[model samples]
Target: MRYVDFTSEELWKQFLPGDHLALDTIVKRHYNLLYQYGCKFTRDAALVKDCIQDLFLYLWHRRNTINETASVEHYLMKALRRRLARALSKSGSMEGIGFLEFKDVAASPDEQLIQQEQKAALADKIKKCILQLSRRQQEIIYLRFYLNASAADIADIMQLNRQSVYNLLNDALNKLRQHTGAYFKPAMALSIILLLVLSQL
Candidate 1:
């Protein structure tokens, strides 16, 4: 049968009925988005890939029992987020070991060198900033920017109200700005931003 581009609900109907094509499309649609979010959650490419693989397999096995959700993207992300968070919590992996498989990052020698330097700087800042975040806050940020999730979508996925997601994001961004004021160029301005963000949160 020819595959059709159907709404998520239709896709779910097909999926639960064991339509292999539907399952294929579902995986293709969300794989990259899911993987990127997974990477942000744990910074380990392999683990994230493993987690995604496990998730897809679990979904395949349980499709008959899976209920329809308004947004499949949100559901997959939520499931992936929960799994990654649980894995991280259980392992507490802090050994500076990377989990991502930066595929053939082919670049000119100069470009590669510049990329490495930038990556190192960003990594340092991220490590410091991440350590300052509450677990909930960290999850929110990861879901929002990394997964490109909308506030409404995230609120649904995270089981929080829309206002709560905004508040959490605001509070987390403020904390990060305060802690990383050194990079923000002006301590006074950064402080003001913090106060504003805190107020919003």
Candidate 2:
């Protein structure tokens, strides 16, 4: 079986039957996205690492219950989001964003060094901004983007009405706009802002 050639759903089916190769292939393909997202939620790289490791372990141990419709990324994100929520609730802040302190958004060897520097600076500022939001704002951001929850899915995840999730997401953006600063380029500013929002959530 060419597990590498399989779709997420196909790998999932094989994995359900206790196929370790299929399970391993699925994890290898999606680990980067999961790790990056894991970095976003907590100050402790160890905690994020543990969460991802544990999540995949649980998947292997309980593959039979895995949802057929969920893509590999969705399952990982959903589990990670739940883990982050638990972590945030315990730590009492989302952007205790300490892991990779964004202190030096400085010039790089790359010719677009200045652009990269500004982007990093914006990301730093956005990270601080995430710490300022209410807990509800943080949770909403998690479900909406990192979890890739649709408005309906977010509403379900967060136990809000559909319109409420929409309103909260817009409000979070408005708050972030005020945080990233007025002089920043809007497009670059927003991309980094959303990154911060997703991370802290």
Candidate 3:
């Protein structure tokens, strides 16, 4: 079967019926995205991989009991987030880590070096600003901007009301602007632009 044309919900339906190919396809579709999001929570790549593996294994084992969800991405993300939380708590690691990978887009070698330094400096500042946010606020910013999730999706993932998600997102952006006042232009919110850049990376 050509799973490439299937939506996540379609693949999920197949997986629920014990279709191994569908399960494999789902893993392929989401693994990289899940890995990137997982890394933001902790610096341990191995742990993130393990948690993703465990999440899929858990799904497979309980496929019959799992209900359909609006977003397969959000469901998997929420599950992975919980698993990472548990693992981090067990290991006494800080739950939030700002790990971003960026590419240099300069033309010349000297220019590339200059751009790399500037981008690195900006990334450091963004990381510090993100870390200063309350955990809930940080997560709201991440899901809204980095994941490009809608308020409804965020509410579903975070188990909050839609209005609460909106309020948190507003509050988080305000705090981010305050924290990043130097980098932010008066007309632009640095959190949105910077998070979008990081998401692409």
The TM-score leader among the candidates is 3
- Higher lDDT: candidate 2 or 3? 3
Q: State the local distance difference test value for candidate 1.
A: 0.66
Q: What is the per-residue lDDT of model 2 for residues 1-201, given as tens digits with 9 covering 90 to 100? A: 787789988888888879999889988988877777666555577878888888889888887776665556666676777876677667777553222333223323333424566656666666667667666676666556555567776665455698887787788777778877763565654445445544433
TM-score of each: 0.60, 0.62, 0.74
In candidate 3, what are the lDDT values of residues 1-201, reduced to their tens digit? 789999999999999978988999999999998998887677689999999999999999999999887789999988998888788888877644333333332222234323555544555555666666666776677677667899988888777899998887788677666776666554545443544446444
- Model 3 local distance difference test score: 0.74
lDDT of 3 at 103: 32
RMSD to the hidden true structure, all candidates: 8.9, 5.4, 5.1
Sorted on TM-score, highest at the top, how do the candidates line up?
Answer: 3, 2, 1
Q: Which clashing pairs does model 3 show?
A: none
**TM match of model 2 to true structure:** 0.62
